[model samples]
Target: MILDAISSAAGTSSAAKDRAGIADNFDTFLQILTTQLKNQNPLEPLDTNEFTAQLVQFSQVEQQIKQNENLEAITQLAAATAATNAVSFVGKRVSVSTTQSELTNGTANWQYSAAKDADAAKFTIRDSAGKVVWTGERDISKGDNNFTWDGRDAGGLKLTDGNYTLSVSAKDADGETVTVGIAAEAIIDGVDFSGEEPLLLAGDTTIPMSSVKRIHNQ
Candidate 1:
């Protein structure tokens, strides 16, 4: 019976449940063994070697279960600490590697770095519904460059304040593509822990912790 319990203990969802079941079965097994030894006749003595071995196995299993529980406790504590640290990112300005940035009031800013100078560098701005609102050419040399939008469309029409996506394509004089690194800066307003990784919320954009590059104090 104790062997069967051991087999089933692996299927238990939590360490606490496994410990409870094993403890109950171990106690019952000990009581049965003690009573049988007491009632055995001296003329035909019962060997206790098998019972002793089983007792040792049960002890090992119980010790392993206790260790698992302790490890689980440590894991939970570490998760709590990570969550607390993520929460502290709120209200702090951060720069993250992403294509999307929020347009507020009248301006939206983005940063990009170029590996080599391009003869022709063109960029397009799109709104939430994948509609291109503006398109313009930029002078992206072999260094860092900042692009700012005035919340206006291609025809000088003002657009609503919301999230915008910027896409850039560049080619050198020889028609070879230039590598560009794009990033955006925003103040983290909230955090979403529902996903596998903690996400920092910044005005309709969900930025993963791994994507963040720098933190600035407000």
Candidate 2:
């Protein structure tokens, strides 16, 4: 059932793109026909059926394009409404399987795992300037382990609330470096649809729908 829904969405997106392409082609064809008529010799005129057939094809394509655009508009409106409903998540704490914590209300959480039992593990939070604001060592299990940051630097200064990248490194018993990854969950303060695509605004970070693994509340 999940696969079916994904396939349906892909098909719809593709159809919209194809419809836009057809509309563009139709416009180009109309321009060419107008130019041809203007440049045609007065004595030797263009063929009637040829011009009529082209015009008919253009009209048919135009209608199809309009229908496709209407369908797309409906889909966009539905998506926008659904996204707007997600705004209720604001001020509520939730978890999502994602990387890059979108800081909200000066708090964010992430989870990571070790491929093997790490002898040592460290969580490092970096600002946009590539400076490490916070770092801590914690014992972690082989599976997912959650970490939280209060948007503070090592000097105990409260950092301005914003998105920050996290890096984790672990060493196995044999002293081999282990790779660690993180995913953060945030409160959806609002929805952004200023552009052609919709995004979920979790604080300063605008996350795309494609990046959203799951909606927490619903």
Candidate 3:
């Protein structure tokens, strides 16, 4: 009987239900075999090759079913781990590559790269309303320049402590425009892990970890 063969091969009764449900109308095959044996004129019986082929097919199908179940279990485990790791990013300030953002508490920082030596470099900071809030000049060589802006207008008025966008343009000794990289810092309020890679959320923008040049503690 198919049930007997399954029980012997599986080595446990716990999987009997699974094995039995695999074959559709399997009991009908057993009934037909019994009837043929009783009614056959003893001249013909079931062919041996046919019976062997059926047994092999059953074994292959049983293996596939077990493999599928194992795969499902593995997928569930991975999903659980991703959910746990994504929560760890909450409430952390991270440095990511971005052009513009509002500076909270009237303070923001920028990183400047010099392509060539400049006699004088000018840094301009703007507020969220696109108004020039502060301007400063520095004599720097061809290198990095760090500039921080306190929320202030040209009139020397302290703006309200909130988010403000910043834009900077630098000129070299030749009075030609030089390219400078701009970056901002923000607190990671959440993380998204459903995609192929993790994404860090900084206030409103989602930034990939690849764009993160450095990390700092404040």
Candidate 4:
């Protein structure tokens, strides 16, 4: 019965549930052992070795459950600390490694770095619905370059303010594809903890902590 409880506790969905089940089962085992020891016949006494082993098993399971609970508390504490630290990023400018950017006040910006000097470079802007809204050519550079969009389509019509994605393709002098890394910069307006981890609210998009490259002065 104790072994079955241990197995069930191991497969429980949450640490709290597992701890509760383990404690309950451990108590029940102790109660049963106590009762047996109290009512055992003098001629056919409960074997000391067997009861001792059962007590040892209960102790081991209890220790394991306690360790699990401690570790869970530590993890929760770490997550809370991270979320608290993220709050400081609000109102600060942050650069994140992502292809998506939000257009606000008629402008959006992105940063890109080319692996090598490119002979030709093409930039494409796509709306949130994955529709290409604008296309333009950019000057090839060896390293980092910044691109700005004025929230206009290819035909010079203004588009509504929303999230957009920018992609760049470049070819080297020998016609080989040049690798490019894309990023965006924005001010953190708020912190979001509704997800598995905390996210920085940057304009209309949420930036994960892993994606953040740098934080800058506002």
TM-score of each: 0.81, 0.54, 0.51, 0.83
Model 3: clashing residue pairs?
Answer: 102-164, 103-164
Model 2 stretches with alpha carbons more than 4 Å out: 1-63, 66-85, 88-92, 96-108, 149-164, 174-179, 214-218
Tell me the deviation in Å of residue 110 in model 4.
Answer: 0.8
Q: How many backbone clashes are present in model 2? A: 2
Question: CA RMSD for every model?
Answer: 3.1, 12.2, 8.2, 3.4
Tell me the tens digit of each residue's lDDT in model 1 across 76-134. 88878878878999999988898888999989899888899987699999999999999
Error of 4 at 75 (Å): 1.5
How would you encode candidate 4's per-residue C-alpha lDDT over 1-218 as one tens digit per residue?
44455566656445466656666766777787788789989999878787677778878867977898899999999998998889988888988999999998899999999999887588999999999999987667878888899999999999999899999989988899999999999889998888889998976688888899888875
lDDT of 2 by residue, 1-218 (tens): 22233335445444446556555555666676678789999999878787677667657766877897898899878877766665655555455445577566798678676676776587888877777889988767787677888988888898886668888888887888886756677667777767766667766777666655545653
The residue-level lDDT of candidate 1 at 52 comes to 74
Candidate 2 is scored at a TM of 0.54
- Winning candidate number (TM-score): 4
Off by over 4 Å in 3: 1-88, 192-198
TM-score of 1: 0.81
Query: Which whole-number lDDT from 0 to 100 does residue 157 have in model 3?
Result: 86
Give the RMSD in angstroms, all C-alphas superposed, for model 1. Answer: 3.1
Residue 90 lDDT in candidate 2: 58
Pairs with steric clashes in candidate 1: none
